[model samples]
Target: MTDTPHTGGCRCGAVRFSAAAAPHHVSYCHCVDCRRASGAPVSAFVGFAADSVSFEGEAPRRHENGPVARSFCASCGSPIAYADSRLAADIWIMLGAMDQPAAYKPTHHAWVREQLPYVHMPDSLPRHVKSSVPRPTE
Candidate 1:
């Protein structure tokens, strides 16, 4: 685990959060589901152990996306994080919501088959047809 502090908030500044440890992994998901939900080319995220993060101010508004649940600030509509009940100990935070996004790097590109034609993926990172299995470290 890396000793890096992670902090972020909603667009309206109503909801704030901080993580004491570095993320388990970061990635850009190009799946159609992600594109529709985020209304962007790809959805970037940083994974962390659920217990390692702390929230302050107002809680996020929850939305159910199939098997996963996403949370965001109701006032500003800033995508905050995705929580999976199946993966009880982990939470996926939106990388764009981070205050210091540079501290994290995408290790992989997920749902490559759904990626837009004009969107070029870096050759350096691994690409997968679907959500990759979480490694033991993650």
Candidate 2:
């Protein structure tokens, strides 16, 4: 909401990052990849332009799976971020890691096909079958 840069770090404080601009999007993802990466039924992320974000403190441990690169706090094992090569212009940070988690509220659901049957979200947002990113016209 405010222009003050959004900041956050890992649970152990070994990894810190700052997002200088407002998040472009915030959403929950139910894809299997997200479930595995986050160790939760679903994952929430706040996205910012790649150029506006920077990382500091201890170097993060990274895992590469297909097009997605996930980073975790090397010291505490807290999930740091999710970056997908297909969406090179943006980087998604774990919503749980934000300093002010309530400031950025998720607006949609993604990867609904992989959503667990028991998970029920408020029926106010659009749900995407896969990614919300619009694919390029062929």
Candidate 3:
């Protein structure tokens, strides 16, 4: 987090956005949904106050999967973010989209039970079979 804002956009440059404040929480999700959505072993994201983020150009293409709604770039099919409609005020931006991904630090590993055995867990993070506490902020 810095006085300077964080900014990023879709790979095709069809979509652009900015965040005025540092992200609140960052994490790597190993849930099946995230794995399928990202086409990777895990999906890394940075959570920000919804009001602090803004978008430009084309809005992300959205997909509803159970309780989660994911956004992606239509042009490049890049995973953008996941917004839980239930918590309309928060947005989880994909870490890969950040211009400064090193600034993103994952706090926890979610859905540990479903994580691939080959995927090693960092002892530093608190691993949970699922979110132990209800994420009111989503």
Candidate 4:
């Protein structure tokens, strides 16, 4: 992990967070859950070890859907993070919430099979039909 820290917050500045270590993974997700939670065609995230992150100010409200828990800012309704118990040590933070979103480099795409027909995505990155943690039979 590099010495530099990653910092971010909600759109309304009601919630803030930081990561002290390098991200384990950075990728885009096209799952229906992610798209619905973010209100976008696709969601991009950076995964960091749970222990490496710190939250401050008003805590975001959480909504659990099965094994996944999504946290969002109550003040501005911006999605903050996604946590899946299957990846216990990892928490994926929404790239849009980052202070430096331009610095993010997505490595791959997850849940590509559910991607919307109208959403045009880059072809250079690897695309996973399902999550690596557990393949959902559709």
- The prediction achieving the highest lDDT against the true structure is 2
lDDT of 3 by residue, 1-138 (tens): 675458888888898889988888888888898899999998888888899999999988999976789999999998889988777788999999887788777888888898998998657888878952256653
Report per-prediction Cα RMSD to one decimal: 3.1, 1.6, 2.3, 2.5
TM-score of each model, paired residue for residue = 0.90, 0.94, 0.90, 0.91
Q: Which stretches of candidate 1 lie over 4 Å from their true place?
A: 1-3, 134-138
lDDT value for model 4: 0.87
Cα deviation in Å at residue 16, candidate 4?
Answer: 0.3
lDDT, candidate 1, 33-110, per-residue tens? 778778899999999889999999998989996558999899989899988777878888999888888878889998
Global Cα lDDT for candidate 1? 0.84
lDDT for each of the candidates?
Answer: 0.84, 0.90, 0.84, 0.87
Ten contiguous residues with the weakest lDDT in model 3 = 129-138
Model 1 scores worst on lDDT over the 10 consecutive residues at: 129-138
lDDT of 2 by residue, 5-96 (tens): 59999999999999888999899999998898889999999999999999998988999987779999989999989988878899999999
Clashing pairs in 4: none
lDDT-best of 1 and 2:
2
Question: Where does candidate 1 clash, by residue pair?
Answer: none
